[model samples]
Target: MKIREHLSLLAVLCSMAMVVLDAGMLNVALPTLSNALAVGPADIIWSVSAYQMALLVGLLPSAQLAERFGHRRMFVAGLMIYLAASVLCSVSPNLLALLVGRVFQGLGGAVIMALGIAILRVVLGPDRLGKAIGWNALVVALSSAAAPALAAAILAAGSWQWLFLAKLPIGIVALAASIGFPPSNSTRSSIDGVAIVIHAASAVLILFAFERLNSQPAMATVALVGVAGLARWMIAREKMRQVPLWPVDLLANRPLRTAVYASVACFTAQSAGLVALPLLLQLGLGTSVIDTAIVMMFWPVAVAVTAPIAGRLSERADPSILCSIGGMLLGAGLLIACFSPASAGLSPYVAAAVVSGAGFGLFQVPNNRTMFLSAPPDRAAAAGGMQGSARLSGQTFGTLLVGLLLGYYPTTDAVSLAVGLGGLSALVASMVSFSNLPRFVQRHHA
Candidate 1:
């Protein structure tokens, strides 16, 4: 790549890393922050959920706003909000203040995430998109993989406030680097106020319902009923608009929709396996918390190894076959891990983890490439938004599923069952991905 392109990609990755790091770093700091703020663990958990809810609800709408205002304008504005929110979180004297900062921070992160890949596409151009996306995925994986260790170091050196304070420099660097993108020529189009409300409401409701499923079944049922009613109205409202906030038009394309299905299934399996593995490792293998964490690190590190190669290879290979094979590999790896003998050391599990992570790396880049490139250039922001939402929704569902299973089946090895279910999800992804094979063949010629 050219020097300019390298710098541009660096800027985009920095923006992504900035948002990702916030969540990752906060995970380890939760107990420390909880004690310091004098809040119960359950209440402190809201600090994380607040950001998640805001991000989930704001992603699509933020993309719509970015399209109207301009990506650069939205990006710079997001940085300011994120940085300001970080300071708020750092000095918060209580849980209420911290939750407020987290909410705004998530909104800002949503704006950044919603446009990061779109900006990367503009920076690198389509011919190199596959490889660039691979790099982006690798960066995200590595950032997540490193978070626990980094958060531990930070907490030992300072306090929980420094975790939020640490975001300032990254945000500033990203802001300076990203200001050079050409301004959007999009006119001051009147965004759909009603549609944005419906979309955001549906997202928040869905997330809330999923989180409540294991804890409060009655509340979750009510939320689902509300979501169903709202979704029906949203479909009717979005279909008539030329540029719908829901992007039902883009989703109508068979290739893109199939790709989305595959993406969602793959991520559901990914999250479920990750969540269940820790418990299974400690119980089945008798590994310590620290040892289990060390073993789990192989997954993302393996992803870092294969994601870029998948990106580079997608340029020449048919992504359908690559993605399908990746899916099968992932499922097979998970199943292998499940059947691994308790007497066998961590080596078998570690190898399985590597295989599963590498498989995910191979799947994600090409899958995301297909999803993004299938849309018209004007729909890039929406496509990316849908892509992000799909992954997030799947993750939430996977975690919820495991939580409910554990609660309902006390004394059972729910972790192994969850891992088995994760395998099933991966197989589903493979089938869905292969179902889109004809499109790949036809698109290559077109």
Candidate 2:
């Protein structure tokens, strides 16, 4: 049973780690790709944008597809598509080819991520799902933190193609293991292509608006207004359907709604901190790239250390308490960071990173467990889709905040503002998580 648990997790979660690695490494390699392809910065950025847009547009739809077909088949097909796209990305000779490959890669990533929770519930059952989530969180946190460092090392030693190629061996093994895994039950249902298109349109509009906001405020505002209208329409349309692609039914449950709120807040805090810290260290403080990387590295290390432990604790503990404490720890860490003296060395910054990362791990494991398990088993895929959506939404908003801040202020001031907002978001997460306490606990407090 233990061996089966380990193998099942590896077969499923390895793709997640691969995706995280790919994202981080590809981000670091963007400048190199720009130079290699002889494209301007504007053109090169489209590669990342294209991937993100595709991922966002495809995520929920992929869940529906998985439900209609079989989850196991969809997952295996996603792995195949992802691997094939990676090869295309690695061999591409032109910008257009790479962009096309990235779009497909993003779609495949969406499929894998969307079904992750559902698959875990199936393979591990109720007994082990919580720990598996912790392990999953650990894998993502570690891979995300390590990706840049690994990319830097690899780029120093060899070609950028290696970044995409690195996941191949792991992909092959997961594919093989996937073939042997237990079959998944399919929910026979029709997919609403129109609804998918509408949701994708709204997401794209908002994403494009965020990107354009720093450069074109009037256009961005207009796009945002359009997005709001589309969002309203989509919500009304989906709410009437028995099982919309948007997970509207599951979201109506108070526990799940609260979980999603806290999930978004936690992600917002992490995203804000991630985007701001680099600018703070490199541009504002005039620190070296290597030094900045080292100090920032500590945060993920802290996450790595805390995630599995938190996972174990989540099985028997109150997630509300764990999540509330986790959010505050992250908030406190970021608060400490914003106050760092300009003349101080890296130690203080490292301390902040460690604290923040550890806090993130604490909040993530239990929060995700709640998010995944809150839904009825039949709707688990939808819950998983919503879970991913919440994360992406939070990250987008957090990044948008940083971009807006940078537009209005200098590096130091912008980072400070961003950090402050991140801290505020973390506190909100803590408070919302605290609200998830049992009635007796709430009444006692009241």
Candidate 3:
């Protein structure tokens, strides 16, 4: 890669890191924001939900839009929006303002997330794609794991507003680096207004249903039904169109669809473990926040160390086999964590974290390579969108699953149960991954 390409990669990584960091950091700062903004806990949840909903709804559309316009233009526009929204969030005096700002931030983030992979596909040749994706995964894992600690440090130094303020410098640097990239040639396509409405409605309704499941079960059920109906309509509508916004044809590929399902399962397990372990450590075992953070640090650190190697290995090995091995390791780690006694020290927990992280890191890059490679070059943006959506949906499902388990087993060790379920999900993912091996091997042989 040339210096310019390296700088462009850096810019993309910076933008990706900022978004991931923001997602994780806000969770840590929610309590502080609630108190500072004089909002009730329930209402404060919207601050996060609004952002997530916007991102989910915008992802596919943004990808299509990127194709219609240009990746470089969309990326720069996204950065500008994100930077502006960050400043708005920092200066907001009330909850509503912050929520609105977060929504815009999420819209910007959707563009960045959707196009980052597509841009990489364009810039990097096929041989180097897996390695680049592996490095990208490393950045995501590292940013997510480091965010809480970074947020804490920032809060200790100043106000919560500084958290948003900190994003400005990174955004500026990313924008500058991104400006040198050549523009993508725009494709001519008529925008599908009805399809856009259907897609957005389905995404928002489904996400809202998930968000309300534990709180307002009745409303959630209704929303779920509405989502199902909208999704059916959307699919039927898209099936008739030659150039559908949803790209149903790409998903029709058996191997790609299987890879997507496996990705979701893996992320679901990972997210459940992440959410449950903190609760187990802090509330159940009476570990301090700092101590919990310290122990948890091992997971992302391990992922960062493992992913690049896994990426390189994918070039020479069957990704499906690698995914299976990684899933098994993740399952084993989660199973070990489930057996964590309340009186036990942190070493056991740390070991489990490291194992799980390493497994996830190994699984991610190869799986992504499989998904990206499966799609036709013309549908790269759609593939990227689908990949991003699968991750976010799986994470949302996992988080909610933990909450549901906790609620259902109020008298039991909910944390252990959730972790156990996560292990089961990982095992299922492993099986699915293994099932893909024959097809992968056949492809290679052919």
Q: Would you estimate the TM-scores of all the predictions? A: 0.97, 0.96, 0.97
Mind giving the per-residue lDDT tens digits that candidate 2 earns over 304-387? 899999999988888889999999999998887788887886777888899999999999988988888888877777888888
Q: Runs in model 1 with CA error above 4 Å?
A: 1-4, 442-446
Q: Backbone clashes per model, in order?
A: 0, 0, 0
In candidate 2, which residue ranges exceed 4 Å CA deviation? Answer: 2-4, 440-446
Candidate 3, run of 10 with poorest lDDT: 406-415
For model 3, how does the per-residue alpha-carbon lDDT over 43-119 read when each residue is reduced to its tens digit? 89898999999999888888888878888888889889999999999999999899999999999999999888778
lDDT of each: 0.86, 0.87, 0.88
Better of 1 and 3 by lDDT: 3
In candidate 1, position 150 carries an lDDT of 86
Candidate 1 lDDT, 317-343, residue by residue in tens = 888888998899889878888888888
Weakest 10 consecutive residues of candidate 1 by summed lDDT: 179-188
Query: What lDDT is reached at residue 118 by model 1?
Result: 83
Give model 2's TM-score versus the native structure: 0.96
Cα error, residue 200 of model 2, in Å, equals 1.4
